[model samples]
Target: MGDGALSGWERSSTARVIAPARPRKLAKVPFVELADGRLQGVVSSGSDIGRVYVSSVTAGEFAYACSTNNNRPCGGARGSYCNHIAAMVKEAVLQYGAERVARYLKCDLADAEPDAASLTRAMLATRPPAGDSKAAATVFSRFLRHLAYLEFDPATAPLPEMQWFPPTRAVA
Candidate 1:
């Protein structure tokens, strides 16, 4: 496995992937946008295949759901950030461009790479400072409500489906 690769934990347990962990390079995989604004596709891998599902959690933030266990840590018990979801974000950026992705998510696409710390700061910074009642009022309902929901159930919350995407081309 490359230094950048990540092996996902077991879908049912906290055990990390014990097999050869590889980074997924799915550049050619086409995705269809589902009715709920999620991108859906099938990662072909002989008999050990799986489905890939990605959704814009909020502007700039994304959520991933997969049927396979070998993936980076997105919506898993281990962490909020993961390579599997990062792959999906790259796909969305490639398909729709960073501008569109950012517009849809309500943040800068340049900050969409899956760095949880930066993402958190950027998210909090978007708020209307501390005393700007006017700006706060304008964005309070939408942003605060969404933020509340996210706080209630962080991205680490297990999604019933599962998550993962294998590399299309192996990188050296």
Candidate 2:
């Protein structure tokens, strides 16, 4: 009753103050490096799905922030670039060099992209003479372990034990 009954001047003295302006959204996206050392970003355009974009420091990386079709954030998912985009950019830079990365942006993956799965398969399929199935299996197991380290999230899915062993190491 005391302050409520006070005049306009008294009310002004006790009024709440407004805080300073701040950015409307969060920035920074998580990125993962491939075995080949390329960076990739995880950007969500809509529907919780995002696309990867290759980038360069000079060109500032390609972003879809200004599209009117979607009100979602352009450079990133919600105003800042996301990790998917970052990863793609990093990978491109590492794989093709900065100059090649720029040229790749204009082309599609089918033209000269390296197929990681196929490469991995080929590497694992190589066999040595002496009819060594055990050695072959061991080599394949190591390859799988390496793949798990690169592409898997250790917190959730741990790599399985390699079952292969050299024949010399096998029990008599």
Candidate 3:
């Protein structure tokens, strides 16, 4: 009883355990350029990331890549922004200055706040030119609106509208 009880409670001398370090979040950076002269930039928040491209197709018209990929055309026959759009825009603003690029794009640099509400309004206001179906145009418009809403308020943003075309009947 003298030594046995106290000996059982003796602390073992061993190295303390440590937890692993958390991975660092990726940084937003301008990285690539497209054939049409659009500059691409990557923005990352943890694992989620996106790209933006900025370019001018005409003398006074500036365009930006609002989508994540560059596989499709943007407006009708006009080229669109792929994943590289955002980066391009950021680089352009740095190289040409925001004022010059805004003038070239015919946009107000003063209102260029990347807020979701403002972006949603702009997307809804834009309508595709004639020849594109109303449904298609509506879908595209809704897409941008949804993106804006998602950016602003992910917790309460509505689900993206889905379009369903009737299946065509094959000739017998």
Candidate 4:
């Protein structure tokens, strides 16, 4: 009690948790998140309901990648961003907003209120030297790990791994 000031850890408990940019309806896309220095997640296959694609875009470099659950490279992602990648990006903008998502991918914005389509275009304009297909495996593994948690019984107490996600309005 010699120095009467609260440490940073003490202040953190009382710090206000900021709400998410918007409500995220995780129906079509089960997982979409900004993590591991990239924007990535597993997106449902439009044609086959049973199939899911792992997609990601690295920050700054914008090295994109997309593949199936079994590591088959996405046909549409050969030279440009594919439909699965598009859908994931769209969902990200919805969950995190265009501004935040754009900033995450390090895209230079030209619009006042940018949306998913505009943000994707901006990232593409960067002309990434190559698409990092290697990222697909990492993204898929992370998605699988998250899915494992769903099999557990619901609980009020949050586990350490569950706390990785950004806080929403309910948590705040």
Candidate 5:
């Protein structure tokens, strides 16, 4: 019982505790970088199957955890990285090289050298004209309204819940 491995009644005690089996491949989902040096993403067991939130911290050392069944073995008893970690790393590496992958995981930009031309372009894009506050305010308001309507629109929404929603019926 002291060892990490559980057997007999302990393994069978809970339905969430899945016994060690073949490591199923994970389908990659879009990942977001958190402010606190972590990456969060949702993965599915298969197409439209069990969705679980996966997060990883890649600071000094790399570590990942899943929101699904926690009783699953970490390396399938082989002492290697678990399926979740492996999948996440693979997805990250595919998007970014091994050397740059850490940047996304940690959201660290200290080492990145700034490009003067791009920085200038970005600053100019963000800065408004010298005057015409009323026009800018009106445009900003319209932009906010467009964004708000997007959340209620099904066709353009990416989330499944936001897609194909039916009209809400009022009850007397």
Candidate 6:
């Protein structure tokens, strides 16, 4: 009906968000994002309301880890994923859905119906050859960096710091 030009902030490519079947409650997992070749985010501690865990599952590597922001290894992440890890997976699925998460992680899944639990089960417990602390800290640092964005007051014009960011990133 008009000139074939992309709308503002709209991409002409296949890249777009895959919304969850049901909206997720972000309170439990305040942050969940897919980046840096993993599914990572901050999950509120179950035992201590004041604490938060930085968790991530490396894509393809299938390596995972969970710990406090201060680098305290999660007591529950022994030979298996902790509840915080599970919760992060669930939130990732909620935000991006199961199929997308599986494909991103390159998970070799069974015939089971796709869900966070199934996706979690598919990941092996092989720890990354590198130290988990370094990886977790990187993820945690990113989380804090993003959190800092929320402190910015509303602006009329684009922020100079973010001008280099394209309107939409191509989905890999």
Tell me, by lDDT, which candidate is best. Answer: 4
TM-scores for all candidates: the values are 0.34, 0.21, 0.26, 0.76, 0.35, 0.73
Model 5's TM-score against the true structure: 0.35
For candidate 4, the TM-score is 0.76
What's the residue-level lDDT of 44 in candidate 6?
Answer: 89
Greater TM-score among 2 and 3 belongs to 3
Q: After the best TM-score superposition of candidate 5, give how far the Cα of residue 26 lies from its true spot, in angstroms.
A: 11
> Whole-model lDDT for model 5 versus the true structure?
0.37
For TM-score, candidate 1 versus 3, the one ahead is: 1
Residue 104 in candidate 2, Cα distance off native in Å = 3.5
Whole-model alpha-carbon lDDT for candidate 2: 0.31
lDDT of 3 by residue, 1-172 (tens): 5855644325423222222222232245333222222222333222445522222222223333332233333332233333333344555454444444444444443465633233323322443222212222333344345457647634565444322222223210
User: For candidate 6, lDDT tens digit of each residue in 80-106?
Assistant: 778888899999888877888888888
Residue range 89-141, candidate 2, lDDT tens digits:
44434443433444333322343343433222222233211121122223334
Whole-model lDDT for model 4 versus the true structure? 0.80
Write one digit per residue (lDDT tens) for candidate 4, span 1-172.
3598876746764343444546677767789889988999898887898899888888898888888888888888888898888888999888877777887788887764588888888788877655667877788788888889979988798587654454545420
Tens-digit lDDT track for model 1 on 13-89? 53422222223445333342222343333223334345332222333334334433233222331234234434445
> What stretches of model 4 exceed 4 Å from their correct place?
1-12, 16-18, 155-172
Worst 10 residues of 4 by lDDT: 163-172
Q: Deviation in angstroms for 150 in model 1?
A: 38
Q: Which candidate has the highest TM-score of all?
A: 4
Q: What clash pairs does model 5 have?
A: none
| Model 2 quality (TM-score) | 0.21
Give the clashing residue pairs of candidate 6, or none.
none
Give model 1's clash tally: 7
